[model samples]
Target: MTPTAVDASIQRVARFGATERRLHTIHASAFVVMFLTGLVLYVPTLAQVFSNRPVVKGIHLVAAAAWLTALALVAVLGDRRALRRTRREIERFDADDLRWLRRRTPSPQGRLNAGQKVHAILQAALALLFTVSGTLLWLSERNTDLRLPGTIALHDWSMILAGVLVAGHVWIALSPDKLPALRGILRGTVPAGWAASHHPKWQAPPAGSAQRAPRAGPVRLVAAAVVVASGLLVTAAFTGLAFT
Candidate 1:
């Protein structure tokens, strides 16, 4: 069936719960802030515009902590069933997914296609690398005489890798075919037809039971606000330290 036809036959489906959506928002926001602040600190030309190294470093660290915390919280409290399903799909790619990757077949995917799964896996690994190298870098700052030989290089290279992966991720996400998935992230629902066409194996919730609206509970809002405020406070405090 054509994508449009498939979508037209299905009802609006809820793909993400409120907690999952909140975690995603927090993670994405923190990554953007970290990427920007890290870029400014790393590039000489960019650093010239914002010469407060301490403040920039502080922002980067705070963003990293927030992003890691969001990931941890999602792991602990997000949809367990969805997480398990995604993990299984990622671990064993279906034949159709491989064929799709090789351009030998045209078929809809399950909850996540092979490409998406691979991306998630790589990003997760990179996050770990960044965390370790970054911690070493921070410690080296306090004890220069005990600095590890390759700690700085590892951290620098990991940042470069992350930038490249994120660029590809953004490009793919913005492509026409992936727009529906992007909309699902923002709205927590996609037209049944679109879901069926893109993710054929995905089972929809029972009729009349789909959550068509995005949840913006007060607690979620407050938590997000606190994260942003904490990032700002970290930046200000470090900037003050630089002046002292």
Candidate 2:
């Protein structure tokens, strides 16, 4: 079903602003191009159809790299605060999220539903997969004189999987009834009517409409720091392995 009409007056937070929204749009567009190009480049039969196989491969590689970098910056770093807020706002398989999914409750202006939570988590996971695997592939190719042990097969399959997941991600993102979600990304605010109709729970009293901001608890902060350090350590280990 198409998205229910949202009012045009909800005050969206300046969460992603204009530049960030533009980045999001670029990332989304590049993802589609990269996936299609990668598919054509991977299959020998398809590659042979085009006389300029090298050119196509180059385009695919550049597009994927650009999309991956942009996603890491925009969705991961730039939206960390927004993600935390979204998680808090939609914690668990709450009655709210379920209601929205079932069409029992209308969508909230700023509140993301269960489907959105799933999409967000999956997109983050896919980004990590692409980055790590792409790095390994690059290092392996750059210094073939120094052996990087691991199956070329593994790298190829990982790339294929990432491409497939990205395509699926795009399909889900573009599904009908996601206009508010799209608009939220574009304008950074849902209309006031949308806010009331969709997420009455988040609506603050007129006297004190300032809702509490989502703050990363100490535990979450520590956990994220650990993950970052671990990623660095892993990359360093791989580089060391390549040299040795």
Task: Choose the strongest candidate by lDDT.
Answer: 1
User: TM-score of the candidate numbered 2?
Assistant: 0.56
Candidate 1 residue spans exceeding 4 A from truth: 1-10, 206-244
Candidate 2's residue-wise lDDT over 1-244, tens digit each? Answer: 1223333433343233444465668767876776666667667887778757656655656665556445444443344554455556545666666767788455543445576566666666666665666566655666775345554455567667666666676676577655655666766554444445655555322311223334556765666566556545654554444344
Residue pairs in collision within model 2: 3-177, 9-191, 9-192, 10-190, 10-191, 10-192, 12-189, 107-198, 108-198, 108-199
Among all windows of 10 consecutive residues in model 1, the one with the lowest summed lDDT is 1-10
TM-score for each model: 0.76, 0.56
- Report the lDDT tens digits of candidate 1 across residue range 1-244: 2222223466577666555566668867887897798889889999999988777876787667667656655554455566666567678777888887888376667767778878878877877888888767765666787588987788778888888988998898899988877877776667777777877877755334533334446766676567667646644544444444
